[model samples]
Target: MARKTLRIAMNGVTGRMGYRQHLVRSLLAIREEGGLDLGGGDVLWPEPVLVGRREHALKEIADRHGLTEVSTDLDAVLADDSIDIYFDAQVTAAREQALKSAIAAGKDIYTEKPTATGLGAAVELAQAARAAGIKHGVVQDKIFLPGLLKLKRLIDGGFFGQILSVRGEFGYWVFEGDWQEAQRPSWNYREQDGGGITVDMFPHWEYVLHELFGRVRTVQAHVTTHIPRRWDEKGKAYEATADDAAYGIFELDGGVVAQINSSWATRVNRDELVEFHVDGTEGSAVAGLRNCRIQHRATTPKPVWNPDLPATESFRDQWQEVPDNADFANGFRAQWELFLRHVALDEPYHWDLAAGARGVQLAELGLKAAAEGRRLDVPELAL
Candidate 1:
């Protein structure tokens, strides 16, 4: 019946994703709700110890949020015996060492992906966490998405019989930052900063594919920097050294082919910024972030290729929207809550650092496949 407060040393609160999703939406939201329910009158509360480079920004956020604990010194924060968890949403380059430090400090590790800039570093970090005997998790927020959840339901229920192929499109135009301000951080365009569509997104694809459908057996990709030049935040022109777009073909288990296109240079033409169309023998589904529509084989419309004339069929009307049967919470918060439960009670959490390493491995191979211009086997990672 006692309330337990978990002190989370959150690194990277100054950044957009770390600020919006992790800090404001997930952690603070959980705190405002009087903590996560641990059942039987027990509650698990989270107190964030904001950690970052900028003291002014950290102080501003803390003052704005009525938080007291703020520290720029990560080592000092980690050295504190009270800090129960270390959550990293920092830039990829900084993540590996920070996670290693956290592991050394014996704090529960939760982090944003790809866990590290490279597969070797990620696996080493994972191994360190495992050796330290600490709880660990990676942010795989897509799995908890309403649309993807529904798609998973369909898969589990055998709605998609003889699952064949998956087509995924994810992107939106990020302004080149010449005339207009870019939506994303400027570091996203620099290869030295660990910024690339393949590195940033392939881990996400790996988790999604591995969790919902199957493990990625093979990867073939074409990655390129569509926008060669871009202006930075200070309106200074710079070469966009990182890849902006990637076209990938992942061979999943059971011979399911998944082709996904991820780009920051492309304009949005689809219903959502991201969508996946899965076709099976029994049915087909088109899923966005929040909505999923399905077309059964029974109701499959037969149409002839009539490019010579105006199309008569309303092809979009054929599929029915999958109703939201349950109220869905914010994906990030849902995962965070599960992570809390996992930390508190040692619940079954599959999205560990090793899984994160696998994601990094997949992405690394994806980039390699792109460079080689050949399909590369995604070997089973052991860490």
Candidate 2:
């Protein structure tokens, strides 16, 4: 078997998500598995070149993983013709310039979404990638989640005759760094640092709703900073300037109405950190990160509202679980595999920079709608 290598310049792996999901779970996993089988005796391998501002952190990662390439100079890395791809998982404020630099260097581009801080910049990145004639992709990892995969199966199988509505609850309390160390980075709570629940989550919602049900036509939202003060990485107190919560209503193309409440301030009492309850003409389903349960219209229970009577039925047990018919990989890794195939074999790939731009547009519009206290139409976005 002949081996082929694609040297990749990876930025921002020091961040939690970038390190855990992309570097460890995805790329390294591929390398450990002896690369992806590209058929015809050619095996595609990914060689990661760790790139970051922090030398000590990057060196630590390289030493820990036995990776050979490490660089702080992005321009120097870009100038290398051996580097096949440039991947960015950096802070939103810095992503635009990095992506443009990668594009100019003629590298195939892939990155975490909200590709830029604003819609216009996102559109520009998409245009640049297109003009460069290089393969490009965005990480829309939620679509590959097992629960949502089952939901997609249901929809495709026509189990849901017509999806009427969707309601979702997603959140868990993040311990303020004062009492206990915050699980998430403190920068997530500062607006000036390009952080907020609306900016962070609405993009996920845009694709989740669009890919699962229909195109989101309009958005109405109430976004607020539920936590006004929190401690940072250094344990110093700072005024939290970003929204920690957002309540959103989206009208989809097929008259499907969806309402979602996203928060970091609320404590959880649900089965999962995030769950979406979908209602349809013939059936209904509730899907979380790993589990999905469904109740057909015929099996749905009927209960009379009587405050005086104790409930006899267990509503939770009424639905049937959706079995995992196929083995599933980490959502991030699964997307990575597809992207590698797309690049190596010119496979049909749809989730590109354009999709990412739409996500950014939705988040931007969501924030605007919240500020204006109005329902705003989501016009068709074009490059």
Candidate 3:
């Protein structure tokens, strides 16, 4: 008998992330001319069954994509027995509600990161998914980046033997919403809405650090709002309450320490490098969005204070461009590939809601530590 095609329904169809990350990139890639190369063999490809969103807006999107299956009703989509997966990319506060409803409807689930605004809610969602016997996953895109994949390879190969410390630099200045058009969404600068770098990005770093080093044991952090006020896309000014920058120190279980600096207030330099510098006894490696570099102590340089001396060679020369095998190899797309494989072939993939919950837990701990002016012992996010 021929296997059934996985009928996937995108819940937040008109949202930027839903359209850009999944629909525009992932689904488009599966088409013959989209460069996906999925037609050469007996490889199975799941088709997007439908997209659900607000009526008028979704109509425009559906027309643009030439998709006939579209609906404005969430319940109608979830209730459809033909749907095999429900993918959610709604705002943070609404994600739990939508996901809970999807799980109740007995659909397998996949969603964007920072699963919920709070740790308890995230955990509950995870538990609910488990109890419902549905496959569940959270998008952890960083791990699939070819640069990070190279870093993982180096780590597993013991290239950086006896690791000592890790440093992460993440940032790029977004427009303050004043004269220029606001670079990011308005919801990103408000507390009432599910906005804040602490929630949005820390979970990303949490997974990266945990994957590279080990489980984080504790955190001491400081968070700040660099730009106090900003204008919206409509030129209306609004006060920014959310912390735009977060600086934290993480204590890994094996005594390895990691320092992370995440912000939206820095100038764009070095190709928006969200790079990690890992220092170890034997050698060191640096991984960024586009490249990975490694250096060993064997050819390590000696310090000299000569002002006229040229800059010494280090990990820069070892850098290489990450290969892109599929359209999903960028952003959340790669994570999508892994999830699809996991669903179709029962392949092992690491990004899960449990790990995503931990990212939220880490951020929560960091925020608490900042508020109370004390170090916080990180709690394990259970499966």
lDDT by residue (tens digit), candidate 2, 1-383: 88888888999999999999999999999999899889998999999999999989999999999997899999999999999999999988888999999999999989997888899999999999999999999999988999999999999999989889999999999988998999999888999988888888888999999899989999999999888999998999999999999999999997999999999999999899999999999999999999999999999899899999999989999999999999989999999989989998999998999999999999999999999999999998877
TM-score of each: 0.99, 0.99, 0.91
Distance from true location, Cα of 25 in model 3, Å: 1.5
User: What is candidate 2's TM-score against the reference?
Assistant: 0.99
1 versus 3: better TM-score goes to: 1
Give model 1 RMSD, 1 decimal: 0.7
- Expressed as tens digits, the lDDT of each residue in 1-383 for candidate 1 is 87999999999999999999999999999999989999999999999999999999999999999999899999999999999999999999899899999999999999999899988899899888888999999999999999999999999999989999999999999999998999998888899998988999999999999998899999999999999999998999999999999999999999999999999988898899999999999999999899999999999989999789998878898889999999999999999999999999888998999999998998899989988899999989777
RMSD in Å for all candidates: 0.7, 0.8, 3.0
For candidate 3, what is the lDDT? 0.80
C-alpha positional error of residue 311 in candidate 2 after TM-score superposition, expressed in Å: 1.7
lDDT value, candidate 1, whole model? 0.94
lDDT of every predicted structure (CA atoms): 0.94, 0.94, 0.80
Displacement of residue 286 (Cα, Å) in model 1 is: 0.7
